[model samples]
Target: MYSPIINISALEPLYLPHEMPTCHRIRAKKEGAPAEAVKGRRPTDVTIAQNLRPEVNIWREADYPGASDTTRELLHHWFGRDHSITTADGEVIPFRY
Candidate 1:
């Protein structure tokens, strides 16, 4: 799966340790996309595509502050599915394991 880091806290800007030079390009068109999305990209920064659709996964309602209606739906879907996650302190937050 082509899983790009959707979590802002998960990485720092211009600090993608795994990306190969000029191997991938990113184009974001949603308000949910982090502002540093382009800045985090390397060697291929350009105008974003109009039809870009990135999958936003809101693990916790508190995590995503300014989610749109469509993004809220995704939150509802994932929350409904009872996905579980561990915090930095190693505590499980969700109901499922």
Candidate 2:
């Protein structure tokens, strides 16, 4: 069982652009659409897209040293079965796939 020393760091967040009119139109289709829901006015699709920032690392050249083919392969293979990874600094982070 070869477990690599994973480095834990905050990678840059990825922002995806959304089609506003399409989103608004879709939202408009839903019945009983309220100007405000629960806490506040439901955020528009544009707002939701802006706030939906995610940092992703793939098993390729994209993230480099921070990511590797071996790591991705292992993670994918052991994901649900193993459930965790030991970082370089010795932190055992639990991940759900």
Candidate 3:
């Protein structure tokens, strides 16, 4: 299945750390074929519409103090303006903080 896109802006500010490489993990249920058939496929394999659970992990860099502009730039670089990710079955799922 397609991986979910993360919305950094939607995340709780309290959960975000000032340190670099703040790791974020997200999980979603699979929808489509059986898991046995897709067992050996790569995580990003989009060849077949397989029912698979996809997890997305991202590490964000640290932001400078009082640097709203820099933070916005980082956010854009990490997550696009739309903040919606499409799955293998063409399902769009919004990221939850």
Candidate 4:
């Protein structure tokens, strides 16, 4: 369970298109016309993508003394997972960021 630690501290909020829908919904076609497109005067509710700023991990790789390959890999994996936030119900939400 390699949970990702989405460090929002260095991340930037993803902005949506100004023209993106705020709440405009699609309508079903009537008579014999093709599918109607989603159109409205107001914007529709849509979410934009999340992105990290600088988008680079500047951490320097350090060597652990006397650590075995399997043990080191396991520690690295578990350590990463441990940093992820958990819900009160104990459900590990993957990609919840």
Candidate 5:
């Protein structure tokens, strides 16, 4: 397998750590409800989207100079299956081709 070395020196200086946005949820009250009904209700739990980072590779066909068409096809097929990630909801998300 041919792998290319990446240079991240340029991106290092631009990286910054910050808090991600969060959403506050509120439940609706029923019609003709007493004022005390509102007091009994508490704020809903905060919901945030998960941030997922997956490994990636980029290469040209020329990099694998000795690879045949069959070998390339098999490699591509295997890569898609191997890099898939299962979410908390039990859904498998494949890497974008």
Candidate 6:
């Protein structure tokens, strides 16, 4: 699931501690896609496919300012049914636990 995060007060870098270090990637896309992510051993989703599109390369902007319901649904699922988030429009979103 992928959701757009607005009002990022700070996006600091997270480095591995001396005892624990891991590298990762931030995949941002351009084209719109359904908001669902696989939940088991094999994990992937439409975002991955859309992001892979030639035009949807890794960029620093959202595919759309306010992603469609599909995007929200997918993201909600991927993130877990138990979290809460706020939209840019001040809408409070509470996930199902």
Q: Against the true structure, whose lDDT is highest? A: 1
lDDT of each: 0.49, 0.42, 0.44, 0.41, 0.41, 0.45
lDDT of 6 by residue, 1-97 (tens): 9897542422432342221123333433444432232232232486765456434322213433466779756755654346679999999886543
Worst ten in a row by lDDT for model 6: 16-25
Give the per-residue lDDT of model 5 (tens digit) for 50-83. Answer: 1211111224324334679888777667643445
Residue lDDT tens for model 3, 1-97: 9886554543454232322233443333454322222223234456343432221112333333345887868766655444568999999986622
For model 5, what is the error of residue 71's alpha carbon versus the real structure, in angstroms, after optimal superposition? 1.2
Clashing pairs in 3: 2-88
Clashes of each: 0, 0, 1, 7, 0, 3
Model 6, residue pairs in steric clash: 1-75, 35-74, 36-74
Cα shift from native, residue 2, model 5 (Å) = 45
Model 1 lDDT per residue over 6-31, tens place: 76642443533323232333554665
Which regions in candidate 3 have their CA more than 4 angstroms from the true location? 1-63, 66-72, 76-82
Question: What lDDT tens digits, residue by residue, belong to model 2 across residues 24-82?
Answer: 11122344442221332235579555455323223222443565778866755754253
TM-scores of the candidates in the order shown: 0.20, 0.20, 0.22, 0.22, 0.23, 0.18
Candidate 4's residue-wise lDDT over 1-97, tens digit each? Answer: 8875443333332322322233332333554333333443334254222122112122213534467888767756754443355699998755311
lDDT of 2 at 51: 56
On lDDT, who's better, 1 or 2?
Answer: 1
Error of 3 at 96 (Å): 5.2
